[model samples]
Target: MRTHRKVLVLFAALASALAGCSSGPNQPDTVAGQFADALNRDDIAAAAALTDDPTRAADSLNGLYDGLGKEVTFEVGSADRNSFTLAATWNLGPDGKNKWSYTTTGTANDTGDGWKVKWEPAAIAPGLDIGPLTYDPVYPKPARILDASGGELMTQQVVTLVNVSQGADTAAVAALIAPLAPGLSAQSLESDLAAAQGKPITAISLRAADIAPVQAALETTRGVTLAPQTRLLANDKSLASPTLSGLDDLWQKSTAAATGWAVRVPIPDGTKRLAGQDAQPTPDIATTLSIDLQHAAEDALTPIAEPAAIVALQPSTGNVLAVAQNAAADAQGPIALTGLYPPGSTFKTVTVSAALQEGSVTPDTVLPCPGVANIEGRRIPNDDNFDLGQVPLHTAFARSCNTTMGGLAVKLPADALTNAATQLGLGIDYVTPGLTTVTGKVPPAATPAQRVESGIGQGQVTASPFGMALVAASLARGSVPAPALVKEQPGVADKTPEPLPPNVDDQVKSMMRETVTGGTATSLRDIPGLLGKTGTAEYIDDKHAHGWFVGVDGDLAFAVFISDAGSSGPAVEAAGRMLRMQR
Candidate 1:
């Protein structure tokens, strides 16, 4: 009986100790863990309920969660009855790049019902009790685009962005905005709006001048919003608008590196910055374009009614000096640099160069230039059937004798012209930065007929105005210089062709000079020491042709093209007007 009583007493004492242990240190640790779990779950109310002052804790927790409304986690370290280490982290930026992590001490008190965390702002952050936290973004200023003379070519400009909700009256929106936005139609706007399905769709972005007439009306319309935005734009709207537009993308990329940010506390007077980084200044982008020459080219092409373009380069360096196109040509896109057209007699430069390299003929070698001739079953004719019979190779080239060139092409190897064009920078691929370009394509002729057509720049022989300008530059420099627009960033060509022989270079230059003095391009003879070639390329039919003139004056080499001009006269005249400005 005594042993049984002792055993019951001992068991009772052990039970009492176990109960006390459950309600003491272990309870505090359990409560701390529950609070951390609640916070990690974003349950501010549940987390506050585990605190001694629930109301105050709820207020601070709500503010902290709302102010930094991003991903957050709380980890509770080993806890005693009094305190525990709380590690908190908030992912405030993309991919946790701006993560804020810190360790704070949390206190727990024994309330009558259970153990609860002691309420204090320091439990969240060391100084979070001061006020609510906010994220302040610091935007870096965009870089300026500079011309060759170190003048600003592109700058930030304010514009209005118009948007329409899906259910808005797209017809009314389109009718009001079509006048300001080119190529926008009511039917297309309605279709796009319906496709967006309640999403806000951008109607148009209008400059100040473009929005002045429609701003009030657009603002009054329902489901419409007009937001002002800053965009990189040309200083002068007329100065290489397409090129500047492309540079805007590059400007955006340059500014995308680092966006500064600050964590602040809002107070009665002004916010106190807790931590932040200052934005880095972006460097200015330099281009190889000459302002004066670009303006000159633009002015020279203004009077032409048809689609016309001009491209000029510095032969010594292959730096693009100017690229200008008239409004008609602009409607067709950046034709001065990318558009391909039959080079016509301008390709005689390549033909003659190829023949010279093949040891087939000299500039003085006699070739027959008939009004019309059938070579390899292909009919070739001189301009207006006016032929010079039994003329020197240089005279035939200057006069652009298609029959002579076609006959010479039929006698050469298949890839001769292609190789020559590559050497002259025509068929070579150039990955130029800040500018998207296609020099041209000269494929190898598989048949004599194709060769005959390719020789005169008709069948498979096509070139951009930029490519022809490069050809002239190569003739002037005795080799093709790598073309580039961005300073210190030369284009990487796929093929590094050797320079032409001095004899071939001199012969081509002499013939081109004769072209200006007495041959087909006599119209430009007034421009002293001008070397050029005239071309009339038939397209679709023999009645209509594109006019071409590639020329060199001093260190400047240029090409002028007039679409559907029916003759090379207009191109020659345009070239003369352009060169007259250089003097």
Candidate 2:
């Protein structure tokens, strides 16, 4: 029994010794645990001190921390008296978009009096034998803007922005760059500089060809800096300047979603790819514009001296085919899509539709075609007061008899014109992507005088070229269509109008055809199946007028507007030119 006791006591002593070895301060696992804890807390000094070579370890660890963006997590995967493995994960970028994780193997050595981790670069990451590590990001190519037929419209181009600091040499900078850019002057630069309030103002952004001649001189100028920026620009600036400017925001959004990044090591020649993802660009953005039609519209407006614009749409699909404006029109902004003006005789179409819907008059009903009539104290007159005694409503409409339309309007309900205009897509608000538009306003007329004026489209009634185009489209399609610019993003209208009655639609269409055939738009009659209306809207006074013509040829609906044109002849001629090219 004494011998058994002695054996058990010896066994107990041996177990206690093993336990002490595992938990003692000199144990290799204790050093490994401490090293991992120091790394977790980002204590580079403490972690390096626990390594065999403190200086070398500190240098490598500092580089690792910086290269990994200072966001790292270290966990002890396996640990023993002499060997250990650590799981390291790094958060490399914002929003947790980039992460790198790997397991590294290292050894702990007993240094007679203490235990320390061996200094090896592999302890930080697998296959990492160098002193420094780097994270390199790769960006994808920007997406292209495509037309409805998959033709490229806009692309990423590099442009240099010339910025002037608060104390910059304004005179010298302006003089050097003024000739390169149009409409820039030294006096204007100084005035703009004073308004900057100590902030740097960008004088201009120039294409590569525009700035190549002065690039060297501008770079040396004091308080001036040239910054290169990648921007989405039209492949042909002359095609659709106003419409293409609206697509920049959408282009940037698509590019960001497909951006890719990578981690790489710097070599003597260039960079050695380490771990990364290759950039894959997103699909091209498809717009509703037809490039061929856009070019044709632009070409047609080139001969006009006044500020003229043209807006075209596909009546069947409500796709915006073209929005073109001449240089004279560009100075006034995107007037083709947003500028509101008195619609003149173009609104007669709406009035006639309203009259037909009320059953007050059919296309065959006889109405007085007086040259001038005092309807509720408002003097309504035909073009040049030319009278054509009692004729059918369709005949009076085709001839654009204002007195006849005013008489019909004064007899109907107050909200008749307003409702008709909305049904034709003039008053409804549209939220279309890649385009900002204003469809003009048509207010309800509560009195005979107001109705007479609204009926002839002269008072409190307005429509944009885009709105007039929609009117023509509605008549052609028998219903109002939701407009769209981007193929995938159809516009949402604020209100859904009821479809036009079949009888009303048929009657209006027949009158429009008669107007082009033998009415005010006979000039465009050469084009087959063309239906149109011409307007000479008086603004401010009777002396100056804006010319307008809205028409539909098969599936194509368009509006041509010329500011201060004095008559509708110029607008009709421009429309003829535009339509002829499409054929």
Candidate 3:
């Protein structure tokens, strides 16, 4: 009986210790329960007040739940008198595929009312994750006029006039008074008269010879009756600047009004003009165009009368300093950096660079220029019966002998030629910030025949004036800088890399120098160190050939492409004018 009592006493002591362990001092669940109750009651202020660090607690809660776009649940996992643990789950988002989990700890705080939950720095589970929100950027509408640097150049604005005439058969009247109208059209005269008057008019059917007496009589009588049952009135001359054409195509894309009457235009000034109202201040746009250079270029190209484009760039940075579109301005397309055209023999610079890099040719490499060479079952000929017999590589290049370049291309692997072309910035998409630009084409396989043509800048190859300018610039700087319109901010270095090997670059520079000294570009002789190449490409169907010249000064490079023009005096003259401006 004594032994049994001792065993019972020991069992009772073990039970008491176990109960004490189960209770523990203060568990995380105790705090979590109070916090959960506060949150469930929809009392955000009360819940915030429960934490000792109320601001941090509010921030933490907002970070977890503010933009959650779904309801969240906080479960009290364990609790004691002074602390608690919580497990939380929330819907990921509208997609509902994503789920989030969080585990947090909290401490009990002695508020005047009772023990409240104070959040401790909690350990979040799975971390915070976010993706694209509702605020993604949308592209804007395209603009009409793009500047040389590919920036938006023009904005739509309104021009208003007081009196615009809806006149009758003015063309007929003008035809009747042919000698009197002289250079003026009947419609234009009627339109001008209607604009002068405040109200619209029908028809003015008198000859220019008949107007003087009628105008004097109208001034005398304020309004006058004329002979043969005619009526006369003095003409008013109020004209509006921002006239709209009422054409759907013109108005739909315009931010300005399109009515024949004056409509409001959103100009730089903060004022608006109503239809038939005059603008408070006239708007004018200053252009980067040099009229003198433009006229000179036009005159120089008059001999060939070809469609052409001349683009000049500052070499250190590729800013388009000037651009000239030839007679066929409408046909030439946009004045973008990457306008496409056959590079012609001007591409020989690339060939020389490739040859030097491959070690297959040197400055002194002897080449036979027989005027024509048969390679890969195709015959390639030089321009206009020109041949440099048994000449050095430099001399052959200066002369732009196709036969010599053809012979060299036959020795190089197709891939090597392609790689070199790629290095020259071919076969890549070029994007102008605010304008459309074309990327010239280069064939993939580049067969021996293709290689030969490409070597001479023909066959399946094309480049723009801007593209060629980049080539000239690369040669000038020994590396290519990223072309930019806007001035770069401070601490930003240009990140573009050099496209060609240094040795190849040196060879090209020497060859180009020879071009200026004695080659096809000898026309530029007056301008010293005017390194350049001249190219004339023949097209089918008796179309006039394309002429090209790309050159570089110390830190200036420019390319001129004259299209559908005969290659002779005009092309050379254009090149001379461009070089003189640089000097």
Candidate 4:
């Protein structure tokens, strides 16, 4: 009876062990059913809470559903106390027609009361299909605006090296590297390399080791390499140090205009700062300048071998039309708008206007012109070195008689002349797009001689072709529009222009018309409806004269000035060419 009791006790212990092993339901659906119910109702939060590692399970489900082309269903393949396996079928979309199958395995840990599923996808199944795989493209950035209308223009750029080797002779290496790095400053490059290495690199000699990491990084990240012998040093071998110096000098002048525009650059990943980097590349500016017209203007005036300036603008819109300065032969600096010279006889228009506005004289007023006129103990002569006996104000202007203009200058108070010049946009800084402009001085109030000369477009009086063109433009539109390089912006487009009184503009227009018709600028007769004025301003030494001509057609206004060149003949010729081109 005792032996029977021992067998029964041993059997009972064995039964208890087996029961613990098989304690979980035969079907793993118990937990899976709850997870499926939550998923079927689109309750991600509930489904996530039911698992031991809900966060991981939820993330996996999110990734899977995100990539699924359709809806899906789950099935239990097998189950045990510690683990379970599931098979799933998904419909690509809401239609639930297209389907895909994936097999997943899950493991459960014994909780105090029951089994709780661990949320590891890898542990579940080897061939589980989470979803389609995707990766970022190698070249994922936007393309840059390379060129406008496919024409070569001046541009700037910064240069740098990746995975370059550092050596003791870094400075020497940089010197050798200068020519290969176009638009990059060697000093700047050295500074950057020094900072990158966390110490001063007096010299750099790159070898295979220094480049390995950079090469590896690029290859791994960008899937590309620096091509063999693609280095710039070999191509620039023939360039001498002096040549580099000359290039540096030119860059300074060209970059001066860069202050007028904004620059854009791409920020690559892992780039911390641009500090100490090589000088950035300079971008080319697309200007309103007409290269063909500029070349022609240069050719036409250079033959006379004189300093000159010319500017053309649309009368109605104030768009700069064309400009030419000193001849190409004598090419100095950019002469388009910065050249300053005396206005000479051209200033008579300003004097005459002042006189009319001050009620000192009118177009029909008679003025004494007996060969010469004495004013403030000085004799002022006409262009012929003498003046006509007595002539109407208009006739005096037409003949460009200096004596009459000098007499009128004395009669008109200095303030009147100053006000007229100021109203016409002179004696003030003039800023324009993509170009530098000279203010062109006018005589100050303190000096009588300066004021007299200023009245006659001499002495301290100076003006650019750009300013003169603006004067003509004022006459054309009964106002002046601010000159611009880019298209005018909205809201403030018309504000740039300053208006003149209607009567004043009309009188100037009539006089300008007479000038081209039969007066000083008869050369412009071929240009129908053209109105213009010519000036032959004399310098103190009388060695050379500055020639000027300003004119206007329907909606275009232009001015030309030739420096140290006698007479306005060449300027007139150039103006005619420009006018024809415009037509």
Tell me, by TM-score, which candidate is best: 1
Candidate 3: tens digits of C-alpha lDDT, residues 315-413: 666554455564464255543244677777878877777778888779998889987778888788777667778999999998888899878876777
Mark the regions of model 2 whose C-alpha exceeds 4 Å error after superposition.
Answer: 1-137, 162-179, 184-204, 209-226, 262-278, 303-306, 538-544
Alpha-carbon lDDT, every model: 0.84, 0.84, 0.55, 0.57
Candidate 2 has its poorest 10 consecutive residues by lDDT at 1-10
Clashes of each: 0, 0, 13, 28
Model 2's alpha-carbon lDDT is 0.84
- Relative to the true structure, candidate 3 reaches a TM of 0.54
lDDT tens per residue, model 1, 352-438 = 999999997998999999999999999898877987999999899988899999999999999999989988999887887777778
TM-score of each predicted structure versus truth: 0.79, 0.73, 0.54, 0.52
The superposed Cα distance between candidate 1 and the true structure at residue 73, in angstroms, equals: 6.6
The local lDDT score (0 to 100) that residue 304 gets in candidate 4 is: 56
Candidate 4 residue lDDT tens string, 222-341? 212233321112112221111122223434544432222111112345222211112334543333434444455545555555666667776677665455555341365655566677
> Which parts of model 4 have CA positions greater than 4 angstroms off?
1-287, 290-296, 326-330, 445-449, 489-499, 581-583
Q: What is the lDDT of residue 167 in candidate 1?
A: 70
User: Total clashes, candidate 4?
Assistant: 28
lDDT of 4: 0.57
Error of 1 at 261 (Å): 3.0
If ranked by lDDT, best first, what sequence of candidates would result?
2, 1, 4, 3
